[model samples]
Target: MKETGQFEVYVEVLRAVIIAVIFLFLLWSDRKNDLKSWDGWRYILNGFFFLTFATTIDITDNYPSLSKFYIIGPTVLEAILEKIVGYLLGSILLALGFFKFVPLIADYRREAEARRKAEEFSKNILSSVDEGFIIIDENYRILSANRAFLESAGVEFTEAVGKKCYAVSHHSEKPCYESGEECAVMHTFQTGKPHNVLHKHISSDGSPYYVEIKSYPFSRENGRVKSVIEVLNDVTEKRQLEEQLAHSQKLEAVGQLAGGIAHDFNNIVTAIMGYAKLIKKKNASIEEAKKYAEQILLVAEKANSLTKSLLIFSRKGTLEVMPISVNDIILGMSELFRVVVGRKIELETDLLDEDIMIMADKGQIEQILLNLISNAKDAMPKGGKIKIKTAFAKLGETFIKVHNLEPAERYALITVSDEGEGMDDETKARIFEPFFTTKPVGKGTGLGLSMVYGIVKQHKGYIKVESKKGIGSKFYIYFPETNEMPIGMDDSTDKFFSGNGEKILLAEDDNHIRRLMENCLTDYGYKVVVASNGNEAVKVFCENDDIELAVIDYIMPEKDGLEASKEIKKINPNVKILFLSGFSDNNIEREINDEIKNAELLTKPILPERLLNKVREILSKEKELTSLDSDKLH
Candidate 1:
């Protein structure tokens, strides 16, 4: 019995010792660790101490004296006392500590999960964006950057953040603006508004490229900008494309001009060459020589006209402003256009009664008309009427707003209408685009309307087109009216001047110039008897006895004007004579002054109105003298 009791006490002491050692170790660890601030851990520490105390009491109870120390009359009260003071109390304290601690642990887990989700969302957004995005603080330090920004900067994210932007991107020691470079971030910070600009950047291959930067201010407080968000888009390819297109357009324009010149000059050269060969023939007679010479002169006139036309081919880059009447240009081209439209098409004009004038480049205006007319002709491969009209207009507020024009009140509107195969909506929309055309490939430059558009805009004007497929198209061009007039201009300058029905002999040595003169006179209602040279003038003069006047050129092939006029005078002393000279050749001017009695010499390059007015003045004076002599005889 005694040995069994001692063995039981030894087992109890061992168990108590193990429990107490665990409690002391736990307390020592908690005190040394960072977990000392944890109230839950502190609660557990108090519970452990109680457990250890209860275990000690159990160990002591193993002794017979301690076991019955609380017993009374063998009622077994010692067991109850043990339960109340040790095991029961210790179990309650442990339960209470666990109950207070579990919720704190759960809260810590939820917070960690939320932070992980937020970081993931931010990383996804940074990776998905295409443009380089960077957040910069006021100190020029890079706070954060997306994947694109890091790649464009040629730096890793780990190497980029917390570094100066200039140091990382530009490899400069100081800020970008300090080196006289434009900084979008600086602009955003200074203005507290969005900033956009084009910047030159270096690529990874060490080549230069362009980038467009759009930066916006963010985190603003108290009217102060705290940070900026920069967005960078590389525009190198787009810029190169634009430059190439402009170059191509220029080349196309030059090609078109060259083609036109080659066609016209070829005809002029052929005629001149052929006539010169004929004149060089060994068996050619004086008359044949004169005839061929006249033909050569005519070719020369055509060349001169072509040269004058070339003067109008100024580039849109410059302007030569002049006050010109559109009606006059229309009227002057009327005879030529009849042949130009190919006999099938009818040309009609409805000009404003006032002979409206507009401020414009004369050559560009001519080009506009020619292009419209040619397009009209092409539209009607079968047959159609092309009508041109000019009217004065007052652009209202609505029109000014729609066209985005300068605040101008009056404008001249020109409309070219064609009854031909019209264009659909898609065609109309793209007609003015450079290199856009409906013509067959290799047939046209397709730059006509596009150039026309550019010229109108260059002059601060506007153009509009209305069309329907299979119906027709009308191009409306508006030019702002200017009050300023060029010097030496008349309200009625007769670029299309005409004459009375007077019978006259027209003589010239230059065939083309003579032809030009004849065309003008015949169109003006004059009875023109044409002569190629001085001898021809004299012969034609005698053939028409009733020819009222003799118009002569001083320089000619066989017989000169001074000699011819002498012969004509012998035929009829009362005959009137007018001499047209390109210039006063000293010898001819001297001879003409000495020999001719009441003849008037007019200079070359004379305006049509000047020529007609001079001829009329001479003829009117002759009639006045005839009337006076007849009155005296009566």
Candidate 2:
């Protein structure tokens, strides 16, 4: 009986020990799997209490009733303690669980708020953009579009939603497919890439529209494209501006090239023309020789006209500004305008006021009037009225603001209006470009308006035109007005002024020009000492005392005309000096003013007549001074 009881107790003890070891292993495994929270630990502690209760039952079972009482008493007390411990642990576990979940709830709330803010920001950005925007799906369906995009297509968003992109926006009969492959959205969908397309679209009002479509793909992680976002921009104005820029650049390049070459060529042409004129004058009886010389003169004149046009294009021509009445200029040009316009066209002049004046080069202003008149005549192939109107305009802030410039007090406004075939808007925009002519080939070089435009700009003036198809054209020329009297040339009081027996030292590089000049001066009863270069001119002028004037070429070997003039003036301060240069780059006028007090400046190719007149004028002035000195001495 004792062995039986002992064996039963040992079996129970071994079973309890095995159960406790299994529970401990389970708790360790839960902790390793990151379940070390209060719930996992509570479950583990409950299992330990259950194991202790089983061991106590097994230990007291094989003992006597009294031993059982001893086990029962502690066991009951242990059960009470275990229940209290379990209650307390259960409360702690609940608190830990609540604490661990709080941060996740706050994180979820923050994520939701951030998403709302991001959505609001996206809506604001898309709404405020000037360009149109459209979002399309991978199947070429319109998913979303902004207000601008809807307005651009002349359709509402509700009406355009879920519609095929090609049908709604492009107004295509068929769906966008791979064959044409021109649509940006379709291309992006087909190739899973971004694409651009520039095409003309028509609005609901049937008006043509220019749009640039850029489509980029929104792709999924699995290498599949989800949707295409099409960004549409209305580039009509931008394209027009770019074209204008290109045209302007082209004209500027050509004008600059022509201007650079004109200066040198004009000098060569002037020499040729001067010699031809001289030959024609000398050999008048020989009709054949005269005709040939006249032919040469004709060619030179043509060349001179070309150079003048180039000068106008480059805005390089010198301005001899003088205040002139606008009314007088219009009246003076009436007969010529009539002849040029012919009897077919009526020329009307509406001169505003006699007092309206502009400080401008008279000849250039005449040319401007001529070009405008000619253009008007050409426009009126079948007879029309051409009106020339002049008026005094106050250049207030209104006018200034239009051009982003300061206001002027007053301006002389000259308008040339013609009731003829006017230009279209496109033609009007490009009319001022050089060599851009509507006239047939060989009829015009297209430089007329360009020359006019350049001249007006160079004179600190402005010109604008208003025209319409088949109605009429009007050109407004605004020249700054000056409150001053007209400056006129002083008339000489000398009796048909001729060169006297005064000796002139003439220096010219060209032999033919030098001899002709010398002969012309000699024939006019004046002796001339000729030199091929400036050095020789200086040597001769230094050796002689009766040199009444020194006419020197500006550019020469060994010594320049300026140096020769300086040396001559050092010897005789009273000596009259004149310079002749081919181009304006030598600064002859400025140099003369700076170096010599009262030196006269001249440009070459010098005409015999002009040369003679200048020589006579200077000699007469010198003789007057000499006589005045003699009178003082007496």
RMSD (Cα, Å) for all candidates, in order, is: 19.4, 20.0
**Predicted candidate 2 versus true structure: per-residue lDDT over 264-367, tens digit per residue:** 47776776767566666755567766666766766665565556656667764555578888788888889999999999999888887566877877767887
What's the residue-level lDDT of 298 in candidate 2?
Answer: 65
Q: Model 1, stretches more than 4 Å misplaced?
A: 1-115, 124-133, 146-159, 202-206, 232-325, 358-364, 397-412, 454-462, 478-634
How would you encode candidate 1's per-residue C-alpha lDDT over 1-634 as one tens digit per residue?
7787668667767856866775686568556755533656656666676666666554333456334333364323554464456666567667756865787768878989999999999789877887888889999888889999898788999899999988987899988789887889999999998988888887768998998988899688888999888888899999999999989978876686677567879999999899888888999999999999888878876675445434322331344468777788788877877777999999999999886667776767777788899999999999999999998888888888788764567788899999999999889999987668888755676767877887777667899999989999999998887667655755655455455788899998888778877877787878899999888898898899888888898777899888899999899888888888755455665777788778888766554576777777888898899999999999
Number of the top candidate by lDDT? Answer: 1
RMSD of 2: 20.0
